[model samples]
Target chain A: MPLNDQLPALNREFIAHFGEMGSRWGINRTVGQIYALLFLSPKPLCADEIAESLEFSRSNVSMGLKELQAWRLVRLRHVPGDRREYFGAPDDVWEIFRVLAEERRRREVEPTLTMLRSALQETPATDDERHAQERMRQMHEFISRLMIWFDDVQKLAPETAVQLMSMGSMVTRVLEAKDRLTGRNTKKQSSPS
Target chain B: MPLNDQLPALNREFIAHFGEMGSRWGINRTVGQIYALLFLSPKPLCADEIAESLEFSRSNVSMGLKELQAWRLVRLRHVPGDRREYFGAPDDVWEIFRVLAEERRRREVEPTLTMLRSALQETPATDDERHAQERMRQMHEFISRLMIWFDDVQKLAPETAVQLMSMGSMVTRVLEAKDRLTGRNTKKQSSPS
Candidate 1:
């Protein structure tokens, strides 16, 4: 398929912008473009279609699809009676978000957590070392707490997560109510006194 | 100062790892190393000290510091009776997180929002274009909602945000309680019934 023939100007612009945005965020430009094309396509697209539509080499499309698959950002499906593999993004945008979050946590956050833990295990031999260890401890604790909260949030069904997010300021109000029920002051604390 | 004299072996390892991590995340390795060094330093470090400690060229150190300053991730300070400027990370890790979130929103998220908005304004000339516009609308709505929620959270005192996060599973419980109070079932909704 001719790229200009199939993809309208608006679609082409959006795909190009998406590709640029992806590269800025550490994703490969071609992979981003491929994902953008598949995301907007109403039907699953085979590798040949993606290559032809994006004007990317077959090898480039293959590599991009492989990377997307590894990130779990795209799904592979076999169209009925068709032997070639087809790729598509999840229908729900939230599902795409869930995959991105989970993958980032696994690839980046988990390793950082490990590094912090190991640093904490090393005994400090000097005042400077002691101070560094303290800093690492704080970092580790903060990350640990965040991960726990994230895991809990991830456990919620996607629809429930959407409902909870839709709550918006109501969630803050709920926290305030909890504080009131526990008899803790909601006022900002500026000092110990 | 000697390149390897003041920094302990553990510090060297940590700083090196941080540089690697930074590169993986689209940050320059030198910048990451400089930031990590400053983060663990007991006092603000001068450019010469950072260059020597990290074994980086003076020019590289200068460029890295400039980038860090732009990101608002490092502070310039002058020690008493000292002419040269020194750099340090914020004492509070949470403060660093706040700066990072703010800077990312300003640099990356806001521009993408603009692009999505512009795409949404264009009239679709075909069903395919219409579907693509619909996808863009979902993305724009999701991002807008997230930014609003983030702005609200950012307004919360750091301690309050920590408290809210520390609530962990209790947050879900609070949401369930609110739903119950409002006479809504807590069962997970797979679809609108």
Candidate 2:
């Protein structure tokens, strides 16, 4: 069926919601809706197909796909007889979780850690500023360690992440154990655990 | 002192990095820089103060302040006898994390869940289409449950979040164990163990 006829009003509303969500996460609304549509779609779709379905410009679809590719949110496919490229999300939702975790850590956490490192090296102007820099250093180190933990997490099979997602409150229990193991009670520890 | 003179080059570099990061996250670059600056500042700053320090337009500062307020990223302060509001990040970084989780869940996750619910109610045209709707149903339910878990996590005290952040790999290990207990072997289970 033609997409316009096949896609109901609910689909459009869902796509629009996703688009708005994309803006919150530092992506455009169109990109979010496009990805959401791809996620719901059973088959890989080409740029023209996506543009037509979403009522977006061809160039806009092109750019959205490009950005999605950079974020590793979409996969490219080539039909056996077709010359055009197609795009789709991974079948497993866990894969999306892994991608989001890894991408956010890279885009947000890593840079903050890097900044904290540089800031720590700078000479403080006075006692008060020195204390603030010290706090920044603590934040940097803490986040760096967290990133390392996430690196270990990414190594877990997609199935493993899926398992963890459903673990619920037990996740918090394990975190508590980890705190005791690390010997870090408060956020600021004078020395490494 | 001029910002160039008062703020070290490294500080400016970090601010610039955050500004760029903001664009990637859908936040205005100046707003990101302003937040980064606030994160590091020893004292709360007024909009005029931020404008003067960053050499940005006063109007930009106003818009940025509004955005920051919406994000719950900046704390409004009242200095003794002063009517002008001062803004700063929470003393604890985990507080920032909690606010981020809550706000994003409310703005992004809840709306998506609503859309998914509506989509689930739509009648499928055929058996194969029914199967597709089933997949979406699983996705929608899982997402809704996950949002609840995040809400629980967000309600946690900052001290607890910091403890978890500091736990590093141990938290993952516990989650791994929890995954085992939850019967995570299946590809898609509507009711997770």
Candidate 3:
């Protein structure tokens, strides 16, 4: 194969793998491929260019772009001296991560939280129903706490979040040091052992 | 509706909602429904019981159980004097979360890390390829750091993790306090501004 042929082949491999990975994360293959293409492109690409390069139908590309836009994963740009609308992924990977986390929380987590709250409002009239309600309460509390923490983390500057993440388990050491200074009982430490 | 009828109706609604939610997370509807059913059950349930309760075919229940087991989201138990296999979710919701995180890390994250590592090994033949390679490296590093942090958190006792999560943004405040004590420059605070 020519060098040019090899390059597209390699790009195709990456695109295909991304599509498969996206399916595992509840995204369809086409959208994943489109996002992968945009992410790897050196410049913004118009719909026609994307359709031609990926050999997707023009309509398919249009719909995929719409989906990507709804997810806030792709941005629209207009090139100088060009009338066509072009699409590209954000240059910063951390921005993409932040958008994904925020969108998923909005679309998936919030609805479940609503459901749990409504379920908990009902009075249980039987032993079985009471048991189920209790389970739901436990689930509700767990999800609520997680979302609270997530919301706080989302508020952090991406760089700060990165710093905290890079600290890894060392954050635990810091927490321990604070506890020692305050003379707080670290009873929970017993559970990990 | 009769009281008995009303109870099952409510349970069914929760199960159906969970199935939908599961699909959004890349789990098939049947597996999600099965797991939800088991999670709410006060006792371990046999395959026949599961099939009858969910009104699914026996084979469907079997396949769902297999998938759930592979995900490590469900466990098998043998009842006294019974030949049939019974299934149940972990009694503790946190334990379920731990299993899911570990299994996904093994099945999904590890493979992607391997791919990124191999992709990085090949020298880029052009400027565009080099830029793409650079983006790939950024993605790889971000994912690796995340996995490291997750691994550390996972090692913490569930109680400790809960405590940490409940602290929410207070943890960030703690970090800032530590920074002041150590005189570290917090340049990233401007990003969120």
The candidate maximizing DockQ is 1
In candidate 1, stretches whose alpha carbon ends up further than 4 angstroms from where it belongs are A1-5, A160-165, A183-193, B1-5, B158-170, B176-193
Error of 1 at A115 (Å): 1.1
Q: Compared with the true structure, what per-residue lDDT tens digits does model 1 show for residues B1-193?
A: 2237668766876787788789877798889889999999999999999988888899999999999999999999988898999999988777788889899998778988898899999999999999999988877887787787677666654574455444445546655654545456544332221
**Across residues B1-193, which tens digit of lDDT does each residue of candidate 2 receive?**
2244456555566667778888877788899989977877888999998998788888999999899999999999999999899999877766776687778777877777777787788898766456557657867866865666566555443455456564565435544544455456323334422
**For candidate 1, lDDT tens digit of each residue in A90-129?**
8777778778989998988888889888988899999999
Cα TM-score per model: 0.89, 0.80, 0.88
Encode model 3's per-residue lDDT on A108-136: one tens digit a residue.
88898888888888888778778888888
Question: Interface RMSD for every prediction, one decimal?
Answer: 4.9, 5.5, 5.1
Candidate 2 lDDT by residue in tens digits, A1-193: 2236456555656667777777777788789889978887778999999999888889999999999999899999999999999999888776787787788887778777777787788987766567667667767766776677667645544455466555454335544544555565424433332
Model 3 stretches with alpha carbons more than 4 Å out: A1-10, A158-170, A176-180, A183-193, B1-7, B158-170, B176-180, B183-193
Candidate 1 collision pairs: none
| Model 1, docking class | acceptable
Task: List, residue by residue over B1-193, the lDDT tens digit for candidate 3.
Answer: 2112333554666788788999888899888999988888888899988888877888999999999999988889988899999998887777777788888988789888888888888788788788777878877888887787677566544564455444545546555655664457433332110
Which pairs in model 3 have colliding backbones?
A: none
DockQ for candidate 1, please give it. 0.40
What's the DockQ for every one of the candidates? 0.40, 0.35, 0.37
Of 1 and 2, which scores higher on lDDT?
1
Docking class of 3: acceptable
